[model samples]
Target: MYGYEITQKVKAETNGNLILKEGALYPVLHKLEAQGWLTVEAERVDGRLRKYYKITEAGDKERVNLLQSLQEYLKTMEQLFQPKWSY
Candidate 1:
């Protein structure tokens, strides 16, 4: 999806808890493209140029790895925050 669409989708998926700014979006998009994690395609829509990004296989692998790491971190946090006594 295009940058704006991606941002909107993420915000919606998170129930408005997360908001992304264009300033950060563009740079991150560019970096992902450079890292071969994303493929950028340009198309002219309504007389304006728009770039769409698709994740590559490598990106999928990385995403899974990151998700696993995050889950572990959350588990650790839960343990740390658990009550000492069951009241």
Candidate 2:
């Protein structure tokens, strides 16, 4: 998806808790493109040029790895936060 679409989707998915501004979004997109994790395609939409980004195989692999790490971290945090009972 394009930058604006991505921002809107993330906002909606997160119930408006997350907002991605252009200043932050574009740089990340550019970096991913440079790293070959994402591919960009430019097209004209309503007389305006728009760039759409697609995830590459490597990007998907990285995403899965990151998600697994996040899940493990969250689980550890949950365990740490659990109340302990003393007899």
Candidate 3:
């Protein structure tokens, strides 16, 4: 559920360019499920049932790791793009 909401928000934040078609989304979700990082259940919305994903404890831990790695990546990019000092 939260991941779906997050996916929607990410899409909106990127002005609809955060393209994760169902093909990609479902595969990553399935991988997470296999790794015990998430679980899914069906939920009804507007009379149609959709599979909802929920993060497990392992997923929360992975989220933290992702955030940390992203931060480090940004820092590296920033340093790499900085102008070099000239004597």
Q: How well does each candidate superpose onto the true structure, as a TM-score?
A: 0.86, 0.86, 0.73
Per-residue accuracy of model 1 over 6-46 as CA lDDT, tens digit each: 99998999999999988999999999899999998999999
The candidate maximizing lDDT is 2
Could you tell me the TM-score of candidate 1?
Answer: 0.86
Where in model 3 is the C-alpha error above 4 Å?
A: 2-9, 44-48, 83-87
Task: Kindly indicate the candidate among 2 and 3 with the higher TM-score.
Answer: 2
Tens-digit lDDT track of model 2 for 16-74 = 99998889999999999999999999999999999999999999999899999999998
What's the CA error at residue 11 for candidate 1, in Å? Answer: 2.2
Candidate-wise lDDT, in order? 0.93, 0.94, 0.83
Which runs in model 1 stand beyond 4 Å of their true positions? 83-87
Clashes of 1: 0
TM-score of 2: 0.86
Per-residue lDDT value at 11 in model 3:
89
Model 2 stretches with alpha carbons more than 4 Å out:
83-87
Ranking by lDDT: 2, 1, 3
